[model samples]
Target chain A: GESVGLHLPTLSVQEGDNSIINCAYSNSASDYFIWYKQESGKGPQFIIDIRSNMDKRQGQRVTVLLNKTVKHLSLQIAATQPGDSAVYFCAENKGGSQGNLIFGKGTKLSVKP
Target chain B: DVKVTQSSRYLVKRTGEKVFLECVQDMDHENMFWYRQDPGLGLRLIYFSYDVKMKEKGDIPEGYSVSREKKERFSLILESASTNQTSMYLCASSLGGSRADTQYFGPGTRLTVL
Candidate 1:
């Protein structure tokens, strides 16, 4: 069975520091990956995404790195703030046009001021 | 922005009772999905519909069914709710396309079956 997993269940960082959340997926055929942020009592929101062909993609203050060979994915947040505290999940598109996502166990990120 | 809304923010039901969770999307997307989130399980897909009157079983579909009578609405039905069904249910929608399609999720419904 294909599965996605995170290396750390929780991560804490001080404000103004950089944070990195790592994820590993077992499905080699998965070509699309996305990072989502879920705050307390809210639905998960899309943060950034990357295709298998791309090694990395940059957003406003976040970046997603994809290492296809190792089936590893990471999200990097620069200058973490208290507002950045949330549960981060990495998902993979398994069936292409089917549009179903396989989500990894979330990594709870806490940014203390 | 894409807007997805669920019928309830929280619900409580007894065992053996029937339950329905409704979801609506204003984006006119072709794909709608129902997922349940647990403490350590993250999000697990229960069911999904790609078009009206069309549906498919996801990774976890036992004891659950879905209805897609209209394009904008998707409903999840529990024939007989149980305490094991208590969890946060999330509804999401996305455009129909390749794997790159981004899904937009609604505020989840927390159901407690006692």
Candidate 2:
């Protein structure tokens, strides 16, 4: 079965430290990947995205790395804050069309202040 | 800014009842989707519409149906709501074409089937 999964269910980090959340996807044909953050009681918000042709993409305080050889993806957050605590998910555009995405079982990130 | 709005934030319905979940987008996007987010199941797509009056069944569309009478509005219908259907239903919209286009999500509606 084609699926997207996470390395860990939860990640705990101290405030001001860096956070790394990992995801493993099974589909090599998946070319586009996206990272999203969802706070409690809120929908998932887009964090960043990367394409298969690129190895890394950086955002304001976040970075996404895609390793197609290992079918792995990672999201890195710098100087983690309490407000950054949320459930993060990684998705791949492998659902047959560009509008559909296959999502991972989210990683809960808890930042301790 | 793309804004996707659902009809309710919390909804309670009885088993054997037909339920309707409405989603509206203001950006006039051509693509609209319905997804259910569960604890360990992740986000499963129920249905998606690419154009007016056109829809496609997604990964988990067994217990649901969809309607796309217009471009901005997409509706999800549950013929008989089941307790297992209790989950957070999220609606999202994105610009047509390209896998890199971002999908903007709504606040989500938590549905409880009693």
Candidate 3:
């Protein structure tokens, strides 16, 4: 069955260090992928997104890398801060649908200051 | 900014009671969705609507129903709430397009069915 999954359940990182979170998707037809950050008691916030045509996209302090051949996706945060501690989720849109997203079980990121 | 607002941040409901979760978006997005978030489980789609009065069942729609009578509002209904239905319900909306639009999410509704 087609699904999206994370590689880790929890991640502890030191402040000012780099953080990497990985995701694996089973649907090859998925053309769009996005990363979201969720703080406690809040909705998931969109961080970055990448289309299948692009392999990598960068934001202010975040980067999203997509690998189509392996059906893998990764989100990287540079200079992790305490504010960056939250659960991260990866979502995929398989197209043909009305822009609905399939989200993965989140990976909790803890930045130690 | 696309603002999605849920009616309640936290709700407590008794078992077997009908529960309604309301969501409204100010962006006039054409696509609206209902999803439930649970521990160890990702966001499971319950239902979505592309246009007013037009809805589609998502991955998990067995115990839930949705209403989109207006373009700005989408509602999730729990016919008979159960303990297993206790979870975070999230609402989101996006411009109708070819999977390129980003979804704007509302602050989830944490429902506790006891």
Candidate 4:
């Protein structure tokens, strides 16, 4: 089945370090991708997004990279803080419909202060 | 900001009981979605409503039904809840067209089926 998934289930990073989360999507038809951050006891919050036409997009402290050739995506966070510790998810628009998205399992990122 | 609100933060229901989960979005989005989040499985779409009184089954719609009487309100119904139905329920809304891919989610409802 065509789906999106993460390469790592958990990650540990030191404060002030840069962290990168990886995702692999199998659907070739997916054009738009997004990253989300979900803290404990809260819902998922939009992080950043990248379109198939672009290779990278930057956020306040985050960056999303898309590789359409390898169908890979990554989120990079600079100066990782304790508040940056959360489960990160990557999503792809559902089969070009643009009305729905298929989310990946997730990667738990822990910042060690 | 897009505000999506669920009816409950936590709910407990017995097996075989009918359960109702309500979601309201103030953004006047034309698209609403219901999803179940479980360990390992991630967020599986249960159903979605594109317009008032219009619905489309998602990837996983069995044992779940939905109603969208109004544009802003969407409801998910569990005909007969079972232990397997225990999971976190998430509701989201989107602009419903070219921009619908960007969705705003609610806090979520943690439902436990006993």
Q: Give the Cα error of residue A88 in candidate 4, in Å.
A: 0.2
Query: Tens digit of lDDT per residue, candidate 1, span A1-113?
Result: 11235343778999999999999987999988889999999999999999888999999999999999899999999999999998898999976657888888788899988
Stronger candidate by lDDT (1 vs 2): 1
Candidate 4 at residue B42, lDDT? 88
Go through the candidates in order and give each one's C-alpha lDDT. 0.91, 0.89, 0.90, 0.89
Error of 1 at A21 (Å): 0.7
lDDT of 2 by residue, A32-83 (tens): 8889999999999999998888999999999998889899999999999999
Q: Give lDDT: candidate 3, residue A100.
A: 78
Per-prediction TM-score, chain B alone? 0.98, 0.97, 0.97, 0.97
| C-alpha positional error of residue A79 in candidate 3 after TM-score superposition, expressed in Å | 0.5
Give the docking tier of candidate 3: medium
lDDT over C-alpha atoms for residue A103 of model 3: 82
For candidate 4, write residues B1-114 as lDDT tens digits: 889999999999999999999999998899999999887788999999889999999989999999999999999999999999999999999888755368889999999999
Candidate 3 clashing pairs, residues 3+ apart or interchain: none
Scanning candidate 3 chain A in windows of ten residues, the lowest lDDT window is A1-10
TM-score of 2: 0.93
Kindly list the per-residue Cα lDDT of model 3 for residues B1-114, writing each as its tens digit.
889999999999999999999999999899999998877677889999999999999998998988998999999999999999999999999999665578899999999999
DockQ-based CAPRI category assigned to the predicted complex of candidate 4: medium
Ranking 1 against 2 by DockQ, winner? 1
Q: What DockQ does each candidate score versus the true complex, computed on alpha carbons? A: 0.51, 0.48, 0.54, 0.50
Q: How many residue pairs clash in all the candidates, one count each? A: 0, 0, 0, 0
Q: Write the per-residue lDDT of candidate 4 for residues A1-113, one digit (tens) a residue.
A: 11235343888999999999999986898888989999987889988888788999998989898888888999999999999998999989876464789898888899999
Instruction: In model 2, state the lDDT of residue B8.
Output: 95
